[model samples]
Target: MLSQPNYREIKSSYLITKEAIELAKLQDIDTKKYKELLKSALEQVLDALGISFDEIRGIKKMDAFF
Candidate 1:
């Protein structure tokens, strides 16, 4: 995700959080806490943006404009 120049910091940060989960390399040792932290971070970001995960991905895909 960070490889995309079109992805701003917020989007990159979001992807980083996801990558952590995908790679099982979260800083927190506890799996439950890892999920909680990722969930809380995602929820706070989405709540502030007034959108959800699916919506963001849809927007990104549409942005390809091909």
Candidate 2:
């Protein structure tokens, strides 16, 4: 199981990456492929950490994009 600090780090990184993808999309940088790749990677990490997307998204302090 991942520790709280590790989980927060991963989650924060994912959020920042997600924001970057959005910026890329706005710039018309072909983010479709990148978004798919990011989702797959994040899903794998969440699975490995025994975390759920719902749980992450449900955090009141954060505004998760997806």
Candidate 3:
């Protein structure tokens, strides 16, 4: 398990990547790379938390994060 601070930091990084994806979309730039990165980061975090992707449905902004 990750320490509380480490977990928070990881989650922050994931959110930053999510924001980058949105910004890229707004700029009409291809967001494929950013989306892939966000997905990978999210998968890792979910694994760390022992949570399934399905468990977060409707709780998080799926389009932004996935």
lDDT of 1 at 48: 84
Error of 3 at 29 (Å): 2.1
Q: Could you tell me the TM-score of candidate 1?
A: 0.32
lDDT of each: 0.65, 0.66, 0.67
lDDT head-to-head 1 vs 3, winner: 3
Q: Is 1 or 3 the stronger prediction by TM-score?
A: 3
> Please, what are the lDDT tens digits per residue for candidate 2 over residues 11-66?
34333335554355566666799877777778889999988655776654355554
Q: 2 or 3: which has the higher lDDT?
A: 3
Candidate 3 lDDT score at position 48: 94
- State in Å the error of residue 42, model 3: 1.3
lDDT of 2 at 23: 58
Reference-based lDDT, residue 29, model 3: 54
Candidate 3 colliding pairs, count:
0
The alpha-carbon lDDT assigned to residue 32 of candidate 3 equals 95
Look at candidate 1 and tell me the lDDT of residue 40. 74
Q: Which residues of candidate 1, in runs, are more than 4 Å off? A: 1-28, 52-66
lDDT of 3 by residue, 1-66 (tens): 566754653333333435554355566655898777777779889989987665675565476677
